[model samples]
Target: MTSPAPRDRVDELTVGSGARLEELVDRESLGQLATSFADLSGVGIRVFDAEGKLLADAAQPVELISYLSTLKHSRSAIESTVSSVKNLDPGPEGQAGIDGVSGGRYRVVALEHDGRRVGRLVIGPYFPPSLRDIPSQLLELEPALDLDRARQLLTMAPRVTDDSMDRLARHARAALDVVMFSGLRALLTGSMHLAAVRESYRELQSKQDKLQVAYDRLKELDRLKSNFLATVSHELRTPLTSIIGYSEMLLEGIAGEITGEQREFVTTIREKGEQLLTLIKGLLDLSKLESGTMSLRKATMEVAPLVRDVAQTMAPHAKKKGISLQAEVEAGLPALWADAERLRQVLLNLVENAIKFTSAAGSVKISARLSSLSTGGSADEGGLVLLGAQRTAVELRVADTGIGIPESERQRVFDAFYQVDSSSTREQGGTGLGLSIVKRLVEGHDGTVHVEANEPQGTAFVVAIPLKRATLRP
Candidate 1:
C-alpha cells in the first residue's frame, strides 16, 4: 500500500545475512549486463537490490505504454501495475509473473549469490506467445484510448514463450554471479588491510603512552635531585667556612704561633677547605639555576669594562701558573643589558679554566668585541651566529694555548661534571661544574656560549650576549 522509499534512503539500510546487490557490482556494470541480456533475449529488464533500491534498468521503449500514459485512467492503471510488479516476491522457486491489461506480461526472477538471494531481475512488458488480443479491461479503462493505435503497438512488443523467458532470466543471473564473486573477494581483501593498519596504530599509541609516563617520572626524579643538592650544600657551607677561617687564623699567628710544619699543614688545610667551599657554592648555584629560581639584577653595563674586570680577577691565577694572560676589549662597543655579577662569573670561570690547562709560557687571552647574530653559521668556527633575525651582541672569547681538547669531546665539556682530562693523574683539577654554570648563566641572559678548537692549539670558549634587555629570559 505504501510507496517504496527513495533509492538513497533504501541504500542507507545495512546489508544483513545477504550482501546488497549494489555492493557486489557497480551500477554501470549492472546496467551494461542488463542491456546486453535485454538485447539478446528481446525482453526489457530492470534490476533492484534487496531493499527495493533500483540498481539499473535497460528497457526498450514501448509505444503502448507511452500511449496509455497520455490517458489519465489508463496511466493510473499502468503505474499501479508497475508498482505491484516491483514489490512482487518470486517465492521459494525464485520465479513469478504478472499479466498486464494490455495482454503483455512481466517475469520476476530472484538474483542469488553464494546460496543467498541478494536482489531480483524484472524481465518485463513482453507479449506472451499465447496472447491473441488486447484485453477489454485496458480498452474501457480510459475513454480517450485510441483502439487502432493500442492494437498496433501491442503487436510491436516482443513475443516470447514462457520457457524461453525463464531461460533468459536464469542465464542473466548466472553472468552476474561471476561479477559478484570477484567484487566480494576485493572487498574482503580491502577490509583485512584496513584492520591490520588500525591494529598497528593502536599498538603505536599504547607504546607512546607508556613512554610519556616514563619521561614524566624521570623529570620528577631530576627535580627532587636538584632539591637535595641545594639543601645539602647549604648545610655543608657553614662548617666549611669555619674550618677555612680557623686555618687562616692559625697560619697568621692570630690563634698563637705555630711550627713551620704546623704552618704548612694549616696552609694545606686552608687551601683544601677553600676548594671544598667553592665546590659547595657551585652546587648551590647549579641547583638554583636548574630550578629557574636564580634572580638577575640586570642593568645597562658596558662589555669592555666587564671584560677588563674579569681578566684582572683571573690574572693572578694565570701568572701563578706561569701562563701569559691578556685582555683585549674593543673601544666604543655597545652596552649589554644583563646582571653584571653573573656575567663576571661566566667570564671568570672561562678564564680560570684556560689558565689551568695552559702549559708554562702558554697564552690565555680574554677579548670582547661587537658582533652581530644572524640566522646562519656555527658559533665555534668564529663569531657566534644563531637562527634568528640579525641582532647586535657582545662576543667574548677566552682562548688559550693549552692541552687541546679533541673535537669529539669539545661539546661535552659544557655538560655538568663532564671533564676532558678525567684521569686520576690528570694535571688540571676541577669539579667540572664551572663550565656548566657558565653555560646556564649565559643562557639566562638569552646569550649563547660554545667551545671550539683554538687556532693551531688548545680550546676557545666563546660567549655571545645580546644587547637587548627585552630579549633576556627570566
Candidate 2:
C-alpha cells in the first residue's frame, strides 16, 4: 500500500523559531509582493521557495526570448541561458548575483527570515546600459540571425543598472520581512487566545466534577445521619419512659411517704426525664420526616380555638419570664384543612420559642386572619380569589418583641438541631428541634411557613394553611 501523505504541518511558529517563508506567506500575498516590488523597481521579479516551488512572478519581458526562439540554434542558446539563470543559487544574505543571458543579465537575491535562508527572489532579465552589441552566445548559435531585430528585442527588455537593481531588491526584501513579522504576530496571538479559552473550559470542567463529588459525599453523610438518629432515638425512648414513670411514682408516694426535699428531687427527675423523652421523640420524628415516612392525620379545624389554646398554654411560661403572651383571631375567618394536634404542636413550638428568645417585659402575639393568596399578590386583596387562585387560607403569625433572630439565622434555625446561639455560654437553653419539628408539621398540612423581621424589633413566624381540605394520602 502507498504510504499515507505526511500531515500538512502547521505554519505557526513559536517565538524565536525559524519558519519557511512560503508557509508564512500565501499565494495572493506573494503575488501582491511581486507586483508591488516590480512596480517600484521597473524590473521583472519572480519568487521561489527552498523547495523550488514557484510562488509568484511579475513583469517578465518576453520580447527578447520570444524573438530568439524563431531560429533553431538561437532558440537552443536562449533556452540554455534561461535555464542557467533560473538554476543560479542565491548565495548569501544581502548578496545579489549577476547571471549573463544571451543578450542581458539576471539579478538574484536571497530571502532570509529569522537569520536563516528561506527562499530566493529573482529580479531581472534586464539589459545593462553598457551593452552595445548582441552577445556571442546568440551570434555563434545562429550566424544568419538578424542583429537589428535581436538588439531591438534586447532594448525592449527592462533596462536598469546593477547598483540600482540591488537597491530596489533590498527595499523589496525589507518590505516582505515586515509583512512576515506581522503575519507571524497575528498567528501567535490567535493561538494564544484559543489556548486561553481551552484552559478556562478545562478549569470549569474540573470545578464541576469536584462539586459533583462533594455533593455525593454530603448525600451519603446525610443518609448515615438519618440512620443513626433512627436507631439511637428508638433505643433511648424505652428507657426514658421507665425513668419518667418511676420518678412520677416516687413523687406520688407510691414507694411510701417521702420528705419534702425527696419529693422535690423526684419531681425534678420526672421533669428532666420528660424533657429528655421529648428530645428523643423529636429526633425520631425528624428521622422519619427525612426518610419520607412521617404520616399526618388531616382534618378541617377552626383556626381561632387552636391559636387561643396554644397561646394560653404558653402564657404562664411567658409570664415567668415577665414577657406578655396573647392571641388574636380575625372575625369571620374560615377553618383550616390541617391536622389539629400537629397544628397545635406547631403553634406551641412557635410561642415557646418566642417566649424563650424574648427579654424580660417583651411580648409574644399569636394572630390569625383570612388571607387570599395569588401568584403575585398578598392574601388580603379584598378576599377576591381570581381564576386559578387559591381560596383564602388562615395565616397564623406568631410575632415577638424579643432579642430578635438575625436575618441570616432565621432560615437555618428550622433545620434539625441547628441553634441560632450554639456557643456553650449561650443564655437560652433547649434541644434545637422545636422549630424544625414545627416546619415539618406545617408542611405536612400542605401549608407554608416562613420567618420575617417583625416591625421595629424582633421576628415573626408566619404560617399559611389552606382552607380547602386536601386529599390526604401517604
| Candidate 1: residue 416 Cα off by (Å) | 1.4
For candidate 1, lDDT tens digit of each residue in 1-474?
342333332243322224567767888989999999889877899999877888889997878888888889977888888988999999999999998766778989898877777889988888887777778887677777888888888888799988888778788878888888777666555555555676689899999999999999999998999999999999999999999988888888997889999999999999999999999999999999999999989988888888888877887888888998999998878778889999999998998889888889999999998886543555444654544466678899999999978989878998999998789998778899999999999999878888889998998999988778474423
RMSD of 2: 7.6
* Candidate 2 backbone clash number: 1
Alpha carbon lDDT at 209, candidate 2: 100
Q: After best superposition, candidate 1 residue 141: deviation in angstroms?
A: 6.5
lDDT on C-alpha atoms for all candidate structures: 0.84, 0.79
| Cα misplacement distance, residue 191 of candidate 1 (Å) | 2.8
Model 1 misses residue 454 by how many Å?
2.1
lDDT string, candidate 2, 1-474, tens digits: 232221212222253244466656767888998998778666788888766668898967668777778778877766776676677786744565664546567777788877776778877777777777787766776887888988887777777787777778788888788877887676556656666676799899999999999999999999999999999999999999999999988987899999999988888999889889888988998899888788887777788889878977887899899998888999977767678988998988899889988999989999998774443444446544343455466789999998888888878989887998899999888989988888888777667788999999998999887667452221
